[model samples]
Target: MIAMTALAGPPADTLWATSLRRWNALCWVLFAMMAVGLATMDGPAGSRYTALALLGSVVLCYAVLDRFPDNPAIRPHVYLSVLAVALGGLAYLRSNYAALFMVTLPHYWMFGRTPRASMGFLGLATVGTVAGSVLRQDGWTVEFFSETVVSTLIVVAVGVLIGLWAHSVVAQSTERARLIVELEQTQAQLSEAHQRQGAADERERLAREIHDTLAQGFASIIVLAEAARAGLDSDTARSAQQLRSIESTARENLAEARELVGSAHRPGQTAAGSVARTLRRTLNRFTEDTGLTVDAELTDLVCDQQTRIALLRCTQESLANVRKHARASTVGVVLTRQAHGVELEITDDGTGFVVEESTGFGLDGMRKRLAELGGRLTVTSSVGDGTRVLALIPMAFEAPGEGEAER
Candidate 1:
């Protein structure tokens, strides 16, 4: 009875707290009503104080809930049906608000006990209700007994059904709230994953651009600086020429870096100079700077501007790796025409790395550039042996005197 009234109105923080407050209030209020009503009435002390004694039983039952210890050896639900049965026995002595209180008392049974125990408690309350009605009567008759019993049974049946349905609704609402919380957590994790993936993709794009332009440019500068150092005392003109080359490479590197990151500056037209002559000059300058001997066989091959650029970039990257890691005194350079395509092979007799062990971004950049143009790179190396880099590009051969090549 107290548990039902314990439910709060709109002001309480939660339903459970309201129920507790209402339950505590109802127990004391019923005790006070019995105390005041019996005392004020023209009744014998036994009848007057006896009602307080009856209500005191209920107060004792409430004390179990009201002053429950923080950590209990036994669960509260285990004894709740026992408390309900005791309260029903006391409500029988006098027909107070406790009789009407039996209507919603099924809620506590349903909450604290299983279905069978709850049904059993309802039956107990029903018996108490019938007995209390019989006690209040002036005389006993079958007609009066049958009418009251049948009507009370009907009301109890309705109240039990309502309690079961209410419990079902609360259970479903709790489960739905749990599912909503899980879905929100999943969405937050998915959003964070997308953010991380986007960041990784941007980093990879920047790495490719840097490997192609800045890394190659820096390698050239190192070689030229070494050359200038060698020529400082012997030949001023050669040193001056090396310095000029260094400056030119730096400026070009800046321009390429800017363009790679999205600038309006595009690289100048390469068709104005023979691609063969440009490669030859770059290789000669590389040999002059490093004092490395080169036995070269060159042939004029026609290809698109993009192919030419890719080939140049690949060659620069390959040579840069050799200059940085190779301790070889002699290197091999070969460019030749296959039946339907061109191949550039650069081999060095230096300490080579195991192919499977090497995972440099420079190699990945070279592979990406070739893959873009339907070209391929093949590397062969083993520890203590020389490394060989081969770039093969399938392209239509342009005839001599053709002003521009098709992309």
Candidate 2:
């Protein structure tokens, strides 16, 4: 933690300013005491000289205190106590200038900075006032002592009030800073949640569109191919083989459409279904139509609905790309879960293209979707070499049966 320095910045409530004002008031009171000493003195030469000295002292003290408000060492109580003790002794020696002892009361205001220092100054001032009054032969009567005691009590009371007020100001400033930090953290969390919600909504919308359009179109194609196969003559073997190919393509498209819709609709619907099952079903349909062998190694690991869906989507899109562009005979899919997160790797021994040079919407869209879920997609490929796609997502598990299970 950084230590707070007096010169770091001014307190928001002008605490230092208030302190300076109190010091200035004390200086003026000291000047008043000097004026009283001068006006009441019996000798003109001594009175004028004392008044000039007191006036100069008051001016110098005020200048120093006012100019260095943020100085850690320049405490108000210390300055006032030194002034009071020195002047109190001088008044006692001059016996006739006893009225100058009134300058001690301002020491009460100085005690606001350090309680212990203020208490020490208060004790000194009380003692000096009594000694000066008595040494000046001011009758040392009960009435005189009573009056001095009353003045000391009043000054200490005022000092206590000012000290409490300063402490309260510091506490309020600390609380304000703490609250600001909490508010910023809350805002950041809210922004992330909003972004996640937006992506989820978009995925649902796209899934609905594909289900209504592409899925239905594939179903129609499958029905027509079946009708063609049934009506074809046995002699037209070549034509029948072509129709079977068309039927296989229609079935593959229908499976893909169903998987896309399932991913969007059942986002968090994790049950006994394993990643391997989902990947196999998707790859089988792809290979049946495209005749590309998919080699896969999938471990049994329970994942949350979102993680499973994201992994499945990564696999589907990757293999789809291989079929369309890789021109390779074999592809591989691997799934592994570690302490930190789950990883999905898809590699195709196809004719690979430069990752940076390839500008395909499918790859970019897959990356964006993963990123929204705090996952990342990395692609490594070049001309002639196989392309590899890796997806990694951080995992945080809730207790089984905690939230509404996805349908």
> Which ten contiguous residues of candidate 2 have the minimum total lDDT?
1-10
Candidate-wise lDDT, in order: 0.67, 0.64
Q: Which candidate tops TM-score?
A: 1
lDDT of 1 at 153: 80
Off by over 4 Å in 2: 1-44, 70-78, 86-112, 161-289, 292-407
Clashing residue pairs found in predicted model 1: 6-19, 6-22
What shift in Å separates residue 204 of candidate 1 from its native position after superposition? 4.4
- The sequence of per-residue lDDT tens digits that candidate 2 reaches over residues 100-186 is 444434344333445566556666765675576577656667776676556555755664565445445555666777888899998
Among these predictions, the greatest lDDT belongs to: 1
By TM-score, how accurate is candidate 2?
Answer: 0.41
The count of residue-pair clashes in candidate 2 stands at: 0
**How high is the lDDT of residue 292 in model 2?**
70
